[model samples]
Target: MRYIYDEQGVTFNYFLLTFIAIFLIPTTYFSLFSTDKDAKLRKPSCNCEACLRKENYLKNRKLSSTDRISKKLAIFVAVGWICFAYLVYKVTTVKIEIDVWDPYEVLGISEGTPLPQIKKHFKELSRKWHPDKAPEDKKAEYESKFIDFTKAYKVLTDEDIRKNYEEWGHPDGKQAYSLGIALPTWLIEAKNSPFVLGVYALAFGIGLPFFVGRWWYSSNAYTKDGIRTHTMDLYFKELRNNSTIKQLLDLLSASVEYKELVEQRPSDTTLLPQIISSVKEELDKRFSEKYQPSKRYIAPYCQKASALFHAHLLRINFSDEDLLKDKYFIAERSIHLINGILDIAIAHRWLQTSLRCMELSQLLVQAMWFQDNSLVQLPYINQDIIKTMKLKKKNIRNIIQLREMNDEERKNVFKALSPTEYESLMRIASIYPLLKIDQAYFKVAGDAIITPGSIVTLIIKLRI
Candidate 1:
């Protein structure tokens, strides 16, 4: 009986060990082989059929209270493990940290802030938080703040960096910070260093005069194809402005008269005719007063205001021969005015690049206009004028030498030319020559020369 009891105890121990192993082996297999499905099972809450079936099975199970509690606890453990695994994966796989230094946030400004306001705010803040002003005891804390402030200020002030900051936020700002910050420093050093600055200065000093001299050589009002188009555009802009002004004046006058009529009583209807006459007189006076040239000589302004008027008129094929002949003197005076403006523009080293080019080109055009008018009015000049005025070999050689001289030297050479030489040189220099119009053959007073091949050549050469 004692031996039987010992064997039974051994068998019971073996049975318990086998049951534990069986439970653990299936769990391990599911965890490894059916990970996705096992993950679904381990979730705390799910709407899937598997989860619903498992939930129903657990609910309907006929078990002792202790057994039910154990099963529920096991389910809770599995769900907890799944959540822990997911949390670990997400923490490991995804970047959870971000850079703290944001230039835009430091500035306390954003896109589309007016430039004037930005400068004002920057100046205000810079004065308050500058490290130099901070007390020695607080210097370390303030110094970090100052560094951040300075960096923000630098980025905001710059156009390119500000644009990048506006586009991609902090990531792009970092790239811009790396590239843009370094460039300005490098540029400053390059500009300040005697060797580098001197080389550039020398090149520019030499090259600028050379370029302008070439431009002068090639200069003519109609020669530059783009200039003619631009000039025409400017004229149209002025015309539109003038038309707007005229319309506004008319509307104001009309409105005033209408208000007066509305205010007057019916008993004064007999006096309406007299009132109307008076109003007409007042309107005329007002118009004249508004249009008056003040102590300020405004004719110069008007001339400039309508600078490209002639160009536009020409473009539209307007027959303004009478106006051209009568108003030619006004145009001639404008040429001198434009030349003076050009002289001022050339002296201004800091003028905008595009405006500088425009002023210079306008000066050249004005000069050409004077030359063209003079030739057109000449009795003997004809289509052959270009060939006739072409410089003799000796003259060409002299002009070449003059080309190599400085501006002052070239001016002296220009002054030294004889009247006939000046006229001849100008004619040859003209991009557009007066074409021969045979009034007798064509029976038309004015006509453009239209020989097919010559037309093509002229168009190509003159860019007409």
Candidate 2:
């Protein structure tokens, strides 16, 4: 038997080789079957799982922990208990017995040793072999020895059993006693019923994760690729079909709501820093629970970002002598602000990872992609000392094409793009490939770190 010990010294029996499985096993059919899952709980303003949960909890102020537990965790607990009960029952029923041929030898006592002396040896041995203090790798060995010590202690303590053992030199007339209490007879006797164990094996075996992965992969594939299966042609098609820079150009165009959206913008760069400082002070006062910045500071963070977005984009000048510098200023400033917040969010356990933020960042990088790599490597200009580089309107338009396509006949299409386009895509992918469209391809591309959820969802691919 290969028994293992938890951090608290709770033993997992040798029969159930499920330490990895229990921790890594995905949630079962319940999560897949639920129609209104976290999709409904997601908040529109923020694109993070932690913020979503926090917002949801703040909205439902009246619901208690018990109500939430019953609605959410009850079914999970019940399903998990199925495997727990089976493993426990299997491991505990080892049918151990004290041979009792020599109680003196078992307890390390002489034939006529008094109870006090006998207990002295038992205490010393018990302390040495205690499972809680045993080495992690040698847990099972110590546990087995501890069980023997306990049974020896039990037999030697019982006067009648000791007397019989001493006189008969064996437990010939004694009835065998169990180390632990017997569970209900029905559960133990159900060993004869192959049907019961089969159900257990099926639910907890490799089969369960195999089924769940298929469900998850299929749904995600369809979401990103429509009816297309494993092949991501449809997904890549939609990906390349985007005209993000064109949309931004249209938004900034004089005709459509450009003047309307930029009525009166505020410039409060200090507001965000002040809010962050205030939240930090408040969080410092609390000692019981750790506070995450993202969860605590999201509202104020977004309030500031909304002001900056309009102030910059809406007021952008197409004819500015230093348009590229202005674009870089906006991008770098935005990146720094968000990156600072992201660092704080990641440090806390409550809010560490996000897929949507990564996706949006990647899209922005794509929109900002420059064909001339050397442009990015140019020496930094001293903004206050040097006049901005004057560039022609034709050169600007050549680098930044955002005009809307009329139709398929007139639309600009690039299949197997030229070396320049390919280089641009490679640059963006190298910097930010966080969307993780295909996990296998993600690994091959050298970007395969995935976040774990409340229930560690195991993704298994099966060929039928």
Candidate 3:
């Protein structure tokens, strides 16, 4: 019917709430907004090739589990912190009342008063406040005071009571133990019982299971790489023994993950035609028509993604803001999808297909498409520059071959590039990995002759 609350229990609840808020604030912040510390933004104003590449890198960067936080959780954390602040204010302002029975205070005498002096004082107090001597109207008040005076006197004079008081903080020994709920008193009242039960039912019965079920279902839908199992199955079914780079692009474009990234808008009905027209028109400017999208029926969104990806490989700069943004995110999220395809290829024991997948993954990171001259990876080099130098005539397929050329030949190849541009290009070229094998041999330890079916160790010394 009713519940009692004391400053002790209420203060404990306030402190408990404050403690919970202290931990939840940071936990919620990290869960909702945490990101990679090393992720840097490129200057939006700088449209240089390097800045463009950096922009793509930032957009397409794969998020680790720790780096992915949703904005919805941020709102929850903010509200929680506000409540916590109020709890903290209550804790600081509340006046706690603790019932401490002090013999000296009750008897109105200083501690360590001699027993004779204490007895004399008690006798004076007893005579003055004794109920027999009090007027009828004041008799009850005097009686209560007298009882407390007698108890304090006994605690100071009697050996056993003094010992109990000293040991257990009470003349009669230990007081009854109480388990404070550390919650507001009104929470447990009869009228509030249904509301409290409903909250408990909503949280544990409904909310908890809902969240756990959602997590379990979502986890099962995707592979360990976070690619959907159904998408992986599609990739496996479509992959052939001799799948080409373009085929791999098609597989990547068709992934269901892009559905979430490339969301449709109310204007897409009219906008889709413009996007398709632009994608086709820009792609034609680049000479690589072989990498054009397949004739097979694909979801409109998937087709847009596929076309954008092909344009990306050809280094086609898009004029549409939404298309560019979508392309960047699609490129980023595609990392997991590509890895999923790689896994499927490896499982099927398709070595060529597996290597192609690996190559595509790397190309995705560099924003280069397959069949582009490897020279495009060098700084300040483009299709026009590569054609002007007649690099193909010199058979310089890679930076390594370019590095192998004599000083005169290298100078002639880069003569068109400015001196500063040439220096930057050379600097990037130098960083390319070049493996050199120094020695190779095989032998069995402590054996004069190698025997059939015997394990042999092959030692190779290599430098990069």
TM-score of each: 0.20, 0.21, 0.76
lDDT of 3 by residue, 66-150 (tens): 2454445566677777877777777778777777999999999998999999999999999999989999899899999999999
- Deviating ranges (above 4 Å) for candidate 3: 1-6, 9-14, 17-50, 53-89, 104-149, 176-181, 265-292, 437-462
- Alpha-carbon error at 396 in model 3, in Å? 1.3
Q: Compose the digit string of candidate 1's lDDT tens values, residues 345-458.
A: 345442453253353344333333212323322222322442334432223222334334565543443554455654554444443333443332322223365454442222
lDDT of every model, 2 decimals? 0.42, 0.41, 0.77
Supply the global lDDT for candidate 3.
0.77
Q: By TM-score, who's the top model here?
A: 3
In TM-score terms, candidate 1 sits at: 0.20
- Model 1 misplaced stretches (Cα beyond 4 Å): 1-97, 160-464
| lDDT, model 2, position 257 | 19
List model 2 lDDT by residue over 149-259, tens digit each.
Answer: 776676678877557666755444544443432233343455656876877788878688888899898687543313323222322222222334322222112111112
Which pairs clash in model 2? 2-14
